[model samples]
Target chain A: MIPHDEGNGTSKPHAPRIGVVFGHPSRQYAPGEELVVRYDVEGVELPAIRAMERTVVWYTEGKGEEDLGVHRFERIDDLAGLAEALPHGTITACLPASPLSYEGVIVKIRWCVRIRLFFVAGRDFVSEHVFEIGAIAPARGVVERVQ
Target chain B: MRLPPFFGKKRGHRRTGSQAWGSFGEAVFYAALVAAGLCFAGLLLTGAVGIGPESAAPGWMRGWLWIFIWLIPGALLAFGVAGVARTVRDWGKSEERRAAAEGLGTLLESMGQSPAAQHPFPGVPACDDLVNSPGTILRYRLPIESPESWTLVGMGLFAGLWNAVLVVLAVSAGIDIASGRIEWVLLAVLVPFVLIGVTGIVIFIRRLVLTTAVGTTQLEICDHPLLPESSYDVLLAQSGSGMLRSLVLTLEIEEMASFRQGTDTRTERVIVWRDIVKEWTNLEITPGVRFETHVTVAIPAGAMHSFGSGHNAVRWRLVVRGQPERWPGFVRVFPVVVHPAPPAESAAVRHGATADGVPG
Candidate 1:
């Protein structure tokens, strides 16, 4: 549930929103295992041009210089779903043997699935949601809500 | 290219730390120089020209005395000067002598050279004073543990008190001279005081310079989850003000092996792979300028991927060192992760391609 607006109660403008979720809601996977990704685009004009792409990458966020590695990139173009539709489908791909996510005093490695929407007039938006790969997996699925 | 593991059991190089023998040798050599200078001054003060009154000595004896007096002081002065010159020429040349001479050599080189050429940032002037140096501003300091710690502790107190005493004596002498109560002959007696004051001032300046001359560096990689046999771009940057004698960037992949030692578990870091990625020498940096370079590092295809569990792991890191001419150099490490290359696909097994020829 969204929190109540601050005092004075002037609501902010509604902007386009997109949501992404894994098929199994699993935040962890192993090498050579197939996993599915699902996406939802909402709150925008119907028949809007968009591209849905899947990417596997590792990145750093602290201390030393930031680094990134792209493991996979697959794009689905002409995503012509209606505004009320969730536009959800299963995307299957095998995981590559990789640097497991790690956190250290001077370094941090994060793995994530990022969706970027490119619109006219240079109004491109990017959102990154992190996941895990390797033997270490969380005990429960992490539920991420879309606005 | 596929290669064996870069991590190994042997240590690669000695980067920092003091050596006992080198320090002792330096102390002895410096003492010898001081002794020679003092002896030469002593001989001159005792009247090196004529041993006695004009008629009190034979002509041959007087000539011999003149030779002894001049020869002793001349030989001593020559020895001291030659020793200093040799030291300057051989500065930071050997590994064994590297640590002890590291601080002094850098400090002297920066003090001697003019300001660095280009600024790191545009429109900002280079630093002309140590107090406003870039290195000092970029790096954090801990109390009493810096490279100059020992030198400061050794001479700081004595130099401060000695300078104070010299100031007091000079002021008193000046008052007496202005009042016309002191003889000009007594003014000659201040020569020893002047020498002592000079020594105190030099030591005090050295302590200040050393305290302000330490440098810091950083490394940024363009990509992470690095793949074997893939080239990754990297940026190396260093911060310091003054003359930089050398800067070296090294990429090291170490194997962290864990084993049972008696009842305890022990982990040992062995550097199995090492490479010198880049080096820059004879650079001058001002306050607005920093040392930065771009380089690429390739991971071997056969190299092991980074792994971590309850017991063992393999790790990779980039090490950057900045050796300033007259200040303390620094070494910084940036850790990285390596991933194994994906398995090659077979001829007929296309996973996601449809008849329309589009990727899923």
Candidate 2:
């Protein structure tokens, strides 16, 4: 797992540290292909983790209201289950065919895996890792020709 | 999934005391409206109000007054119900979040199922409705985005309603004149209304004539859910009795983006690319026959497939523009969908050839 920092400068010393590793090194996938993700948590105990959620979703960004679609989701609250998954976990899902990752002039679609940890004190921390879904080339802005 | 917050402290970060107090105050206000509505309804239904037949008013007028009075409770009840529903929905969302935080829901693993399978391409429009109608020569007929008949009907309705008001005003003025009492204000108003009514009629007539002369434009395609780098046959049919100066068919791709600006939401669309597919000049059509022709349309090899989301879209359309000999020019649009290209291996297999263009 590659460690990732939350980057919240004010976070306490005991705040959780999370890392995620994609199955593929390049983090790129084709349509109908399986995407594998593994994540690890550090500096946080299992008992203090009231709940945890893992999700894979695609969302739109840019000059429009954001739209999202969930591809996979799981929640765990059992302390024993949390302990088993605390240090490390693996998730696999088959990506959808459409809505391939697009980099357009005004709109873009992206895929990401989110890991959220809810502590006993009612505070939650989320970590996100982005990956590409398809090999479509980026779009170019059109130049208008006056006739 | 999340559970209701009926039993625990609210989830998420703690808020300031004042913010909590403000929310409590708002809830109380809505609750008070509901209580007031229920109390008023009970009083009205139980005949607690003093309205009766003994009131000093005619029976017909009293009936209207009772209806007007009942409106008070009706409006209150409507507002109260709407407010209650909104509150419940909001609370349910909060509870859902709490439940999620508590990990009380079942696992929702959409492993093999795609977003398209569950929601039919969440943001993209379903093409079944567009492809429902059959065509004469092509496999499917595309419906125009906007029909001109609706515009003609709107114009007619506006002209009819405006003239009706003008007639009522003219009769009122005539009655005043016959009584030897002239209301110059009413006469002056009549002058503008008469001019406006005449202008409305003239405009409506011109639109009607233009619509009848330009007729309908029908586009038919050989296949749908088009693939990139593929060519398909399209049929164009125009029906009307006139000399069309020029008819041009063009393929266009447009980008649409919507954003919220303060209190208002604005949507902007720009035609990013356009290519003229075919053009005809000096076409004559009889009333009984239509002008029909077939053309081949090819999607560029590296074109972007059609995409749609809640607030953004890349759309493809075929537009037909025609300028009649005497009437105004008209344009009709037909929307189409372009799906992503198939994998190279699948394409090669289907085409009975190797990837390098050698016979298999």
Candidate 3:
């Protein structure tokens, strides 16, 4: 469905609403279980990692494997704080970055979430729904904003 | 006129990945050029913002050197990328076709004719493959365009960067001499780069012409002959594609000696390959695009007495078909030899009729 409202009970007139979804949980992740961080970003469709639980160790790209950022999400405050810091159109659930808690479960996994943004159409005479990323299978977590 | 659909309504060219070497290497080459442009821009801006007047004389001399260093490499990168992308795109289209041919299988068989074929909205060419490739669903491909213009543009960008760097070097040197800035001393060493850029600009112009592929149909002697008897070396070399399989290949020979003894040379004949040239090939890549073809013919040489140089004589003839437009269904023929081959013996035995003693 085309979601028009952000997760925090807010909506913008011109902006497209963003949402994420996890797959039917496929295989196991690296050292820890997979963690998927989603954001129902409105009026814009972009994704980026705002913060991590620990200092950045390393990241790489390969087939059947993706190394996302390692972040500690101790409380909800850290998640919201980092989310607000990121540029609107850059960070999203589908992007390579995510927020994590220090005391809570470590969120370090690639997103299998397909974030689609729905915006009001202009002269095109059709509502615009764009997938922020291609097919992704999120292993865990709810849709939360980086801020 | 459209040829018969024997080869099927040929879709746009597809990549067979059959290209063992294509724009892929050139892609890397262009990407590296983009990087070089960025690096040169950075260096130019640095030299332009140099420290002041105290170091004018030394700084001025150094600035010229940096301009040369920065200009040539940067320009080469620009032209290489600009020109390479166009050629690569053409090649990729060929590969894409290859991918589609096998990818669609029987479903693609009745494209324009079958009722089950996936047809786009009102368009030309009757059929369209737009399910996977959203782009170019309805457009005629213009074959007359060339990407050489991009090379010239890239050269222009490189020139601007070089000039910018030169000015920066000049300004920074003047500033350092007047203000006696110590850090500005580092800026003076860039004079040589300026010189290289000037020289590079000229070299790049020559290189661009050498590399571009103009769609010209040129076939020349394989090698230049030092003597009248040049071993009859002939090879057909061209850099463009789009020749049809049924094309009438005409090879005109002009040399000291020529002879055909066996099927080796005659089979390969100076004729266009009717089966191999225009292929609807595809198999996860462009079909094998290259084939190493060669043929050797035994040329009968005269006693070397007819010609003044006691050398053999080979004449050249231009071959043309009567029906030029009705391509493919054609024939290949050579100029008549001055002396004809001996008449063949009749196979039919003279059982009834005789020449003189028997019944007529």
For TM-score, the strongest prediction is 2
- lDDT tens readout by residue for model 3, A1-147: 233222112234544444433322332222223334333444432233322111112111111122222222121115465455323322222222111111111111122222322122211001112222112122122222111
Q: Candidate 2: where is the Cα deviation over 4 Å?
A: A1-15, A142-147, B1-122, B147-151, B178-183, B241-245, B281-289, B301-304, B341-360
Give the worst 10-residue stretch by lDDT in candidate 1 chain B: B351-360
Model 2 Cα lDDT, one tens digit per residue, B1-360: 232233333222222122223445566777788788888878878888848767889888988888998888778778877876765555412222433433322225434557654433434555777789998888899989855767878989989999999999999999999999999999999999999899999989988887767788999988886666667789999999879999999988777778898999987677776778899999998898999999877776556678887688878889899998988899788999877655442333222111222110
**Predicted candidate 1 versus true structure: per-residue lDDT over A6-69, tens digit per residue:** 1112222644565777755767766566767776656555344344444556655433334455
TM-score of 3: 0.18
Looking at chain B only, the TM-scores across the models are: 0.37, 0.70, 0.22
The weakest ten consecutive residues by lDDT in model 2 chain B span B351-360
- lDDT tens per residue, model 2, A1-147: 222222221346676788888999899988778999988888887778788877877777766766666667677788877887787998799877767787766677888887878777655666778898767666566534212
TM-scores for the candidates: 0.30, 0.75, 0.18
TM-score winner between 1 and 3, please give it. 1
Best by DockQ: 2
Whole-model lDDT values for every prediction: 0.52, 0.73, 0.31
The A-chain TM-scores of all the candidates are: 0.67, 0.86, 0.20
Candidate 1 regions with alpha-carbon error over 4 angstroms: A1-147, B1-212, B258-266, B345-360
Q: Could you arrange the candidates by lDDT from highest to lowest?
A: 2, 1, 3
CAPRI class assigned to model 2? acceptable
